[model samples]
Target: MSFISIKNVWKYYDDNLVLERLNLDVEQGEFVSMVGASGCGKSTFLNMLLGRELPTKGTIVLDGETLKDEPNADRGIVFQKYSVFPHLTVLQNVMIADEFSSAKVLGWTFGNNKKLIKEKALEFIQAVGLTPAVAKYPHELSGGMQQRLAIAQALMKAPKVLLLDEPFGALDPGIRNDMHELIHDVWQKNKLTIFMVTHDIKEGFELGSRLWVFDKLRDDPQAPNAYGAQVTFDLPLAERVNKNNVNEIIEKVSRN
Candidate 1:
């Protein structure tokens, strides 16, 4: 079996069918991006992979096991909005995440274990080029830096899968590009499996080793009011053309 598999998955909200018969297989250590317009079920899919939401009809498997009731430490999530504790310094933010992942509640109690967590947190902070800002609180940093801190907190857990839900969407273009570069570097260094949901088409093409487009269709009988969305295309990064060809591909897919 693939490292992560979604077999004929279907999702619904009350009577609205959001996704239908979606199947995907993600290899270990691969970076995949899911892209579409807003309310296209990208976040829902990410939640499913994180075990926060169950598919209405089908199954999702991670590392050969089915998703459980609660999210495990094996998967790390970074959302667009900064979820860091404003009261905590950058170092504290990361250290707390490590402690929680390690199942240690005494994160504030200074000791050998706490020191080790501190060291690990610092290591990740430096990895994301935030060592100098580690002493500052989230309020003291710029928006981009806060996002970087959030990324560091997620990576500190050493999760087997990293799920990013438009983590850089709120940043300016320059900062967003920088975050993308940082994400690329971190993925290369750690070979972590990533499943990202983004609306930026360029970002999706740039970061994804494989790309999946979720498109809604009204032709299906099962989906009339809220037609079940379909997986229109899946392609490797190498095969995907640049901006010049992307429009053509999109146009072709839309016509179908």
Candidate 2:
């Protein structure tokens, strides 16, 4: 069975339809990447998966149960911008996840398991290559280091599913390359189910085991906003296809 099932979903903003009849089945531990033209409902789909938005029609299921439509420890997300708190040090940023989540679930105080959580935070921080910056505040770090801290923060709960939205888009090409490697290792080590949304076709194809191209199937120049997008192309990189062929296929299908 699919770990994440999105069945016949549609999204509407008042009279405007953003997504129409979308369906997908994402297996556990699969790394899926998505690409689409801007305003093609890519972010909307991610938000729905994150439980930040509800679909206008149809249902989404996770682990054979209907989605809770609320944020929790089951899923985590990282974005392109500053994802850490400027006022907190890196260790505090990581530790806060344990602090809040435990409080919510166990009615716990910081005194409970303080040493264990700190060690886990530090371990994850070091894993992300941010050990030296443990005591530093977010504002004092470089863009790359700040993003690393964000990643550690997101993984604090050991969520089963990880969602990334243009996570390295703001970094330099060199730094972005480093992040790509980091995330690849993190995914393998944790066996995480990941879904990333990227505008860079190469990066999307390079990172994902499976690629999902979202684009409008029909276009009306006279009424551009009337139609919506779907998963026009779903391909597995493990198949017998080269990068050039994959790129050509994505380019061909992404046209509105």
Candidate 3:
């Protein structure tokens, strides 16, 4: 069975319809890069996947179970903006996940549990190239460093799925390239299933084994919000392709 499944999914916010007719099946360990025009329900889809938002209709299933209408350790998310605790050191930020799981009542772990959490946090921090700054606060780190810290924090739970919403969109070109390499390494090493939403078409093709384009197929000039976005294009990127084919896909996305 597919690791994750979306069947006839639709989302609405009161009178506004945001997404409609989404049906997909994804296997474990697949990296799916999602692209769409602004306000085309890309972030909304990610939120649904994260369990922060429930579908107004239909259902999302993960690991053969229907998704609960709340976030859980099975999934982790990183956004474009840095999501870090300003007062918490890098190590502490990552350790919080373990602490929450181990010491829910106290909000902190002690003794041998604390030691083990610290060691595990250190390993993840090192994995994201943040070991040297383990003692630093979020404000002390640069944007890229902060993002790396966020990724490390998210991975602390050892989630089966990772959701990235424009995680590298704010970085400089060089820093973005570095982050790309870092994320690729992290995904491969962890054998994670990743769903990333990006505006960069080239980055989508470069990083994902599969790509999805979301767009509204039906439009109403009289009532603009009457219709909603859907997955207009789905492509497999595992095969080698020349520049022309890539350009064609780019054009197709742009035209819609």
Error of 3 at 75 (Å): 0.3
Q: Measured by TM-score, how close is model 3 to the native structure?
A: 0.97
Tell me each candidate's TM-score. Answer: 0.91, 0.93, 0.97
How many clashes in each candidate?
Answer: 0, 0, 0
lDDT of 2 by residue, 167-198 (tens): 98999999999999999999889999999999
**Model 1: per-residue lDDT, tens digit, 49-167?**
88898999999899989897588888999999998999999999999966765665644546687789888889999999999998999999999999899889889878999999999
lDDT of 3 at 56: 93
RMSD (Cα, Å) for all candidates, in order, is: 2.3, 2.2, 1.2
lDDT of 2: 0.87
TM-score-superior candidate, 2 or 3: 3
At residue 118, candidate 2 shows an lDDT of 90
**Candidate 2, pairs of clashing residues:** none
Candidate 2 lowest-lDDT run of ten: 103-112
Question: CA shift at 77, candidate 2, in angstroms?
Answer: 0.6
| Residue pairs with backbone atoms closer than 3 Å in model 1 (clashes) | none
Any idea what lDDT model 1 has?
Answer: 0.85
Best by lDDT: 3
